[model samples]
Target chain A: MSNSTSNTPEKDHKSSYRAEERRTLSSGEEEFFFDVKTSDMEVNMGPQHPATHGVMRVLIRCDGELVTGSQVHLGYLHRCAEKIGENVEWLQYLPYTDRYDYLAAMNNNLGYSMAVEALMPGLEIPRRAVLLRTINVELNRIASHLVAYGTYGLDIGAITPFLYAFREREWIQALFEKICGARLTYSYIRIGGVFNDAPPGWLKEVGHFCDVFEEKWKEYRDLLALNHIFIKRTAHVGVIPKDMAIDFGLTGPMLRGSGVDFDLRRDMPYMAYGEAYEAGAFKVPVGSGEKGELGDSWDRFYVRVEEMMESIKLVRWCLGVIEDGPIIGEIPKVIKVPAGEAYVGIENPRGELGHYVHSDGGKVAVRCRVRGPSFTNIAVVEELMPGTLLADSVAIIGSTDIVIGETDR
Target chain B: MELQAIHDTLKAAGVVGLLGCDEPRPANKKEKDPGRAGMPFLLVDPAEIVPLLTACRDESRLQFDLLIDLTASDPAADGDDLWVLIQLLSLKYRHRLAIKAHLPKSALSIASATAVYRAANWHERECSEMFGITFEGHPDPRKILLPDDWKGFPLRKDYEFPTEYHGISCE
Candidate 1:
């Protein structure tokens, strides 16, 4: 596996000495040279770099330190999950969903399970299954937001918050492992219900974590949000307006940060969000201060923090409501949906993660199209990146919370 | 609000007859008629697309601002014409309209909507590269998601996936 290299001539002593002489040109002559050949300079950000958060290559066209334009190259982590969904059975593809957005595996599981349930309506899942799904998804949401906040901080040169955020996330992953036997890609969620009920003492452990998390939340806010330097780096930067956000088809925190007041879990209320809980039971606090200024990077960061707090509230609510019942519904071993097409969307940690399933009453889905939130959210970069500094682009992209797996899937 | 009212509005704007919208079914299914579901999508003639989309946006009951998704599907094997489906969502009306236009397998040309919606630039480019369709007035119509020197559209039914591109295997 030898790496490929370009065969361009290296800059030896003669070329360097000649290049140095050109730098000392007169001002008038330099202006003439600049006017005559104003070719765009190409700079490759990475196929292997740290700030990208994953294997993504962006070719940035720049005029000095200002980014003129950028072309994002994907397929670095393309596993063809959609094509794989076609090949596998309907029930077996739940595991592959975890790999799409591994940061929020439970949300991925919930989205796929909801799509299947919508296709095969009247599966008769017990109340316990719904509560367990809500708890697992909210826990996943907290873990995902922790990574987004931690990595965003890391991008802006903060190290302590990233370590603290991961320290808390490890505990949540351990809770998931105890229930499903696998940590990250736990395909615990089934078509009509979940794979198994929560183990003994699982609810008690989750309850204790929620109490501990409330204290840790204050510490996080004090450590990072209250810091003057972090605020200066984030506030009023990468401000996404509400109208432009709607125009670009943005959703989730990206939309809520813009003061849209639209959440699928609240607005559409799939799963146990509406039926099993009260209206104000799980309150995810959206940031509110001013009108046009709501969607700035600071608000975007604060929205995630408040969302973590809300998820904790929902987890506690689920732990209280969870009871002993049949976990798996009366679904046949070989599942077959009706011959029709349905588009099912769930409020994933990222945004509106939708699965459009078309079945022919066959063994496998005829076509399964995923409307990835990252793909739509990242498209607004062309609208946002025109007049920003080169360095601020990284901060803006990080704040959007895009995973390349979902973007390129 | 209804498909007929929107169709009448487009007709008043000098569009041709609105082709019947066909709800696609499985290959082996016996049903061939397009009925009125809870939400109905109207298919318009390809030549009248630019005017119809413009009228649909300007009309009071139908202000389809958001182009939800656009893609081309191969229907030649199913004894049907090749069609491009443009799904539009109206935020004001809270409705979805799927406009369909059929062309011969060889010639798949439609008017570009980049002038109407800025977001259609990349979506049209992606469709063009995947289905070998041509958007007549597309600005900077270049290949996206695929290389410039790539041979054929991979998503087309008869198209074959290449083993390598510029010495890098696509696999």
Candidate 2:
């Protein structure tokens, strides 16, 4: 990587033109040899701006069309869910996790439940239940990625992709409703296992949805994933440096987008995902930058698109092995977690959603902290967002696919 | 390569009296009373955190580069002693280790892990505000999930929740 002011010029492409200070131009308008300007426009970009992705305000200072610097204002949606976790019993707090990443509700439930289960000694989840959880979460991943794909398209001014993404999301939601009777905030994944077993046709319906999804996901790829406008808007924009990505604790697509071949499900191996990965049912899709430079906004967006396909393969594998058995574990109805502390990190659509449960020898947890991935993922923008086009801010945030619901929580 | 073996190496390297300086044991297996316990962690002195963390990251054998998570718990016992959880994972070695620092609430501060792990900035800020534990020497120690005007640390075990704020009732 050469030292250049020209868009940090890609590592391989070094330009000889030095961005030096000094010089004058024709006409009355002066042009400095370097691009330094005295004046900067400070714009408040949102707590409500659709592009900021839900109640996140970025105070962006720009020199003409280029953003000079920015400061992010968060906590517009802080409900103190962790404080509430201290008051509620282990099982009672399931709904709270749903709110953290409402887009990937089942994944949230899975992470929290697994954390609590780790506190209990010799607690075993039924084989059928684990399969059911793997399937449910992968489906949720597909659903969440669809929203990412759609909103990313929307951010780049492609409205058709949003509608198409939601078209698939609605179908996934319908399947979830058949299982747990809730579309957005389903508190179905209980601590021991799930709230209930799959309804009679739910498995078959999900299996059928997988078949439809394989073709539809590629249809989505054709719609906006490969569209020229989307590529131009995203490729090479908001390129996250590898060191910054790891230092900021970025996970999920954001880390993978930077060409880091790590996913907790595959590397850490939890639930049935370990078995699935070992059986070659799924592969971790790292960002190779087929459309643009690695770690760029395009790679971030492309990672999510590729992950949905990997999820489809995992779901299909899970559907094939899902057996008939009890869904819930042998947890006490009162749900008293013995005095202990356990932390479990699960791979979510956004990244690693870690749940820290500290029990105080009672029914309720002493302190329950949620390590929301979006919370960490959003921090990188403070460093990467500057020195980019003002319009590309929307592109960067969309590619990051942040749900401020979790970021602010 | 494993966390237990690394601890043995640390002990051999003269890093003792951790978890409890003189008394280190799991919370459930304290021997005063016995029950099933979760993972056991070592307690380090506040001053030793940065150096230990540096060694943990730079040491070729125990290269715990990723600080997976950092949190503090307000146990709310007699002495106002607070517990901080530092979870570490070595991406290259594939092992996990945790260190618990018992910071006396009278001071409520310790060396910031930011010097070792840049990711601790936000986590430290959140810890500072929520549990009232300050990560001393943190570059940006602003409140993360709480407002600037917020009064008390909400996650503190004994902290009271305000029934109202300004002109609005919280209920």
Candidate 3:
């Protein structure tokens, strides 16, 4: 209920108190009794809050219900992943990569592996291994997006979609378990190739999953994306303009939601994405602001939902072309990368996951820097939160789809 | 644009501190590795970082609107200078350029690139706290990923890891 809607006698007295004080001052008499002073309240909404999605604290200063200022406090979950990367050997650092962005561990593994591989001049990834990497990465992308979709629904007070989204995500985890024997942080994508190939009937099972996911994707769209309540809460809230989005260095759905039409997978192709694009496997979906303002929370959320279908298409295309061959490349167990520095940026589900490796032509790395997308993408929230309502701030944070592991890594 | 062409354009635009490009060309069969195998970068003086980056963003032919990454890499523990690395991307031209600025330990300060690109705000903050390189003119110069009262620069080569924090054992 707003102050204007409630016309109680007490509120009328409080509202007219200031004018009455001015009028009495002119008459040279003091009649000040009511002392209703309201100032901006400082609210700490993080470090243990569910809306934060992880251990992040936002020190929000609000005037009544409107947020006046916000300062994001991080480092609660910082494990110094980069410091660990520099200390560990070239191949031994793969498992550490899985810990950062634990939801999309495969993409993290691929990013770290690709960076190390770039420093090795003679390393060649096998064809079958490349296809498998693409398939697993895309599958992980779907699983990551599903979590983003489901959690965003929960953030908007829709609970059923959370369970529905998790059901399909479990299937992807099961498929990963069959191959790598780990559900969440599967360090399957090794340096030159994958740790192992898909099991005998794994590809066919993936095909079945693609078919079932296509049907469920529509249900998700209807249940949450097109729901009136969800649209109303998200549309026109936390709208990031195109130039602002680029200026903040937002990637993935956040950038595309502003209609930037740039995807590292399509524009700056790596892995099998180039061939898949040439084969007309999938199309990059940019938000057209069908519901409300462009680049709002709804557009960003919708882009993640739509990207799930495109990922399925890319997976299907990879399933069509995967041939029987060696899965892992011929590299020594203890590897020594050449003396050089290389930076490899890949399209993680959240955004651009970059790994900059500096090697001394030895067993250990000199410096390892990870430019995590969540770390950069989360900076925009400080700009978006001041003018929005308290609830809309949660919606905006959910739309960013940041993993604290990636943000603090 | 290619690295060579981008270098020439910066020179033509009268952007100072044009300190030659470091292209990662393949070494000879019998030659030793030069520790340069990734993207080509242009080395620049630490004092001219702001104007050179502003030129890169303002030049129509360059139009490097996106600041991809801003970081500092400590090449050696005993080295006198720290290397400040900046990565820029142009959505219009779809090309990338890397800029490296050498900051001596005696004077580890440079103009903040936040004036040219807002994305550099957090990146510069992280670099300052990590490498102890002060970004002069930065709006908010605070520790990003570490505690406000934290001790030493962890990413520095010679820094020692803390044994305890607030009476809790870190080891």
User: What DockQ does every candidate get?
Assistant: 0.21, 0.58, 0.68
lDDT of 3 at B12: 97
User: Least lDDT summed over 10 consecutive residues: which range in candidate 3 chain A?
Assistant: A6-15
- The local distance difference test score of model 3 is 0.87
User: What lDDT tens digits, residue by residue, belong to model 1 across residues B30-149?
Assistant: 575322122245777888777777776677767876665566655334434566666665656555576768867756788887776655667688779867889999976886556577
Q: Which ten residues in a row have the lowest lDDT in candidate 1 chain B?
A: B32-41
In candidate 2, stretches whose alpha carbon ends up further than 4 angstroms from where it belongs are: A1-38, B12-17, B20-32, B77-79
Candidate 2 lDDT by residue in tens digits, A156-266: 898988998899899999999989999999988888888778989898998898888888888898888787767767777788767767777788899989988888888
Residue B70 lDDT, candidate 1, scale 0-100? 63
Q: State in Å the error of residue B27, model 3.
A: 3.9
lDDT tens readout by residue for model 1, A1-409: 1101211111111201222233222122331222333455788877776777788777777655545577777667767576577668898888889888888888888888887776665578788898999999999999999999899989988999999999999999999999998878988888888988888999999999999999999988878866767776666557777667766667688878877776778766877898534646676556563321467777878888889998898887777777888888899899977655555677899887877565657678755656677777777765665444577778777888888888766
Kindly indicate the candidate among 1 and 2 with the higher DockQ. Answer: 2
- Evaluate residue B169 in candidate 3 and report its C-alpha lDDT on the 0 to 100 scale: 100
Q: Which candidate gets the maximum TM-score versus the true structure? A: 3
Name the docking class for model 3: medium
TM-score per candidate, chains pooled = 0.82, 0.92, 0.93
Ranking by TM-score: 3, 2, 1
| Candidate 1 chain A lowest-lDDT run of ten | A2-11
Judge candidate 3 at residue B121 and give its lDDT. Answer: 97
Per-candidate count of clashing residue pairs (backbone under 3 Å): 0, 2, 0
Give the Cα RMSD of candidate 1.
8.9
